[model samples]
Target: MSGSVAFADTTFIRYPRPAAKVDSHLDYVNELLTEALAFSPRKYQLLPSKATMQQGRAVHEMKNGTGEVDLLWSMSTDEREKNLIAIKIPIDKGLLGWRTPFVISENRQMFKAIKTLRDIENYSAGQELDWPDVKILENNGLKVEKANSYEALFSMLEAGRFDYFPRSVMEIWKEQEVHASKNLIISQDIALHYPAAYYFFVAPAKRQFAEDLTNGLEILIRNGQFERLFLKYHQSSIQKAGLKQRTVLELQNPFLNPANMPLSRTELWFKP
Candidate 1:
């Protein structure tokens, strides 16, 4: 409220999928956005969009300034950064890239014999068609089965369409529980690691607005609110991951651009 203005922009954010409720991912992002704008020099009224769309459609809407989605949170890729105004500072603190590969509990033995990247090359992985993970997997010489939707990926995995599915550490445990009946199990033998980030994006014309959000987040970081929020939502997931015990198969993330990342900020990232 430092600057007095007669009018303020009411920013529109995408609604969480499934309408009546939001998952922890969206819930955390929503609260983070609110915290960033809470004491900003400029006032912004945050409101969810009237309806929801898939990530692919949402990306198009954001790029075209379609008004249905004013802002989106997703894994940052080279293409997304180039087309939309990215906040640069990763909201997920680069945790999204740390993946856990899961498979049907009955078929978990598929990965048991694998010990190295070349050993797992013949096994196919499942990923959303539009996800940046697809390119990352392929870049590392893995075959990927593309799913059109997130929900379909698990069913496909059960059907033996793909050898396994790699999901982020923050997401796999919860999803495994949600689809408990599917008998999917996280591969205890090996996990996947990559350098990736998740970020907030805006339309190309909203560079100043993006900068405002970035500065606001920086303010939260300086005051310790940012890490607090992150831990509140993700700390348990980290502990449950037990990453130190797993044989992590590290992979290269060709999409991560060091220049666009706040690599200098050590406190912002999590190391396992």
Candidate 2:
């Protein structure tokens, strides 16, 4: 006869909700979280916070332990890792650092002219003020046009307030669809490359939960579940992004510690 086994207590992991509508559907990150937690030994319930927060505010709350949000996902940086318990696994497999720009059709030739990092500097880039990518661009000596909100960035690009808006390959298609009425097109002639890792960062004082997630992710990796799930959601996007056809201009992420990058596990990244 079989009997139901109960755990001591279920851990409710509440991640934050964006202050503004960022996407119609959740990214692959959320799905990865659901799948990973399902494999954990202890029972867990993943939920979203009722409070709306911006990227910077959410990180601040996580750092200070002032919020009920248990964890959040973002590109890892030295500062964030120091303040939060980072899982160190590249959940997005470093795809967030591979940027493809969206340009108004008339300005497509402008991007086509960007053959080098210096050429890229001639045109300003649009990014949220809180995003670590902004600092990366500034570190690389590029001009940036900052926006206060996610939706505003798109509108700014259309209004000619910014020359180009570079988005991750995984994000470009969906964003383009959302703003289909706009004349923006993903620039296939150029891509900006930088080595970065997207990590699930546990809030301050949540070390135990962090370890559990890390372990579950490792379990997924060892059994090849991680790779399979990653490919299922991202392979088609990768192929359609036409990354290989673009002239790759590499950039540096000064805020990230090179030593901290789990590059040895080459399976955790997209090769192209």
Candidate 3:
């Protein structure tokens, strides 16, 4: 039976389509899924939808199996893994775990003194309402304020509603560029780190598709195409993050599911 794979159109995942209309991340996953079904008797189509984070998850969770969305790439948690079929391989090579703070440019000096996790605990952080990172930060004894939209979080921080917004190393620079009018600045003094993996999750009813995806990803990893694609998109972002120069404040991810044990799979994660 032929089926379709649907992806959420989010700022984090989807970029402006160039003349070639290739989204490096989306195309990589699509390639894996295409290679996966190549051995099967079925064909699959790729569907793109404009959905926010919450909408994407809700669509994927529909029990009737009639939701318009079929797949999502997000950080995995115990509760989420139980509800959907996760293709446990990390897509970003652990870049999501390397976090840097974003603060109003005027408040840049305030972060210079914050050297440890304890120092950060006294300040409020901002995250999206439905993000798993909120719980991860809260579990580590840091207070976090929630915003309903991605762009609003910057505005909230700018208004001093929150002290800082920690973003992924891969994303901070691009975001700063996008929101430069808000006078946002990235912290040069410290980096926050935890073990987090963003995985592709399929609808519960699509177990066979999940298996096909997993197999295809493994094949890509084996042939080294996975690394090629990751480096192609992220090399500059990683270099600019300057992780080695910053003081790292490591924390535990209480939401990480034990069954996934992402740390044990070194090949699937990026060390930088």
- Evaluate all candidate structures by whole-model CA lDDT and list the values in order: 0.80, 0.84, 0.73
Per-residue lDDT of candidate 1, residues 101-174 (tens digit): 88888876777776788888988999988788899999999999998778888899999999999988888877
Positional deviation of 44 in candidate 1, in angstroms?
Answer: 3.0
**lDDT for 39 (candidate 3):** 52
Candidate 1 at residue 245, lDDT? 84
* lDDT at position 88, candidate 2: 84
How would you encode candidate 3's per-residue C-alpha lDDT over 1-272 as one tens digit per residue? 12223223211112112211222255555665556555543445555544433633453443236554567777778777777777878888878889999988888787677778998788899998878899899999999999876767878998999988999977776677767688688978889999888788777777666676677778778888878877876788889888898889999998885556666778878876
The residue-level lDDT of candidate 2 at 102 comes to 91
Off by over 4 Å in 1: 1-9, 13-22
Q: List the residue pairs that clash in candidate 3.
A: none
Per-residue alpha-carbon lDDT of candidate 2 for residues 99-186, written as tens digits (9 for 90 to 100):
9999888887777666789987778999999999999999999999999988898889989998899999878888888788888888
Q: In model 1, where is the ten-residue run with the lowest total lDDT?
A: 15-24
lDDT of prediction 1: 0.80
- Model 2: weakest 10-residue lDDT segment is 1-10
